[model samples]
Target: MRDHTEFDSFAAFCDQSPWAFDDVADVRDVSRARLDEYVAGRTDFETWEEMKTRAAEEEIIDQIVS
Candidate 1:
C-alpha cells in the first residue's frame, strides 16, 4: 500500500486514475430534506466507544469477506 500520510490535494490524487475493483456509478441527486435526515441519523453516535465498536465490527466483516 502507498503511504497516504503526507498526501494533500484530493484533486491531484483523483487525477492519478487509481485502480478500483468496482466500476464508478452515476451520482444520484437527492432532496435536501432526505440528505438532512440521513446526516442527522448518522450524527446520533453519542461517544467514541460506540463509534469504535461499530468500526471494529465493520472491519471484521470486511476481513472475513476479503
Candidate 2:
C-alpha cells in the first residue's frame, strides 16, 4: 500500500482533474457537449473509461484500508 503522502498526492491529482469528480451532481448535470470537452482532454483523462478505472481503483483501495 502507498503511504499517506502518496495518497495525498493522488487526492490532489483528483482535485485538479475534471474527470476525477464526475460523480458530483453538478458535474453529471452538464450537457453532453460540455462533457465531451472534459473527456476530450480538458482534464487529465481522455475518456470516461480511464476515469472510471481510476475511480474504481480508488474505491477498492479504500475498502482494503478500511
Candidate 3:
C-alpha cells in the first residue's frame, strides 16, 4: 500500500472532485466538512483548507524546478 501525505491530498482531492479547478462555476457541490474528514483520515492534514495550502506550495516548487 502506498502511504499518503499532505501533498498527496491535492491529487486525491482533484480525482474525487470532478469540478475541483472549475473557477467559472462550483460543481460537485459536496460537503466541505465531509471532504475535510476524508482527507484527515487519509493524510496528516486536519482540514481540506490546510491540505490545499501546503500541497500547493509543494506543487509550485515542483513546477519551478521542472
Candidate 4:
C-alpha cells in the first residue's frame, strides 16, 4: 500500500514471534534497509540463516500452514 501507517503496521505484524505464514502482501513499500535493520536489530535473528535455523530447531516450519 502507499500509506506509511499501513506499511508500518503490516511490518510489525510480520515481526511477531513464532511467525507462520506462506504468503503476505508484498512489502516493497518498505525499504530493504529498513527491513534488514528490523530483522537484525529488533528481532531475535541476526541473519536469515539464523531465523531459518531457529524455526527448524523449534520445528515450526512444517507446522506452518500454507
The numbered model that scores best in lDDT is 3
TM-score, candidate 2, is: 0.41
* Clashes (candidate 4): 0
TM-scores, each model vs. reference: 0.34, 0.41, 0.55, 0.36
RMSD of 3: 5.2
Residue-level lDDT tens digits of model 4 in 8-34? 443454755234433454444556566
What overall lDDT goes with each candidate model?
Answer: 0.39, 0.54, 0.61, 0.49
* lDDT, model 2, position 42: 37
Residue-by-residue lDDT tens digits, candidate 3, 1-66:
023463444445555553465542342365788777776876777877786687678779889999
Write down the RMSD of candidate 2 (Cα, Å). 6.4
Query: Which scores higher on lDDT, 1 or 2?
Result: 2
Displacement of residue 28 (Cα, Å) in model 1 is 39
Model 3: pairs clashing at backbone N, Cα or C within 3 Å: none
Give one digit per residue, the lDDT tens place, for model 1 in 1-66. Answer: 012212243233223322221322211244435434432444344433453466578679889999
Q: Rank the models by TM-score, top first.
A: 3, 2, 4, 1
Worst 10 residues of 1 by lDDT: 19-28
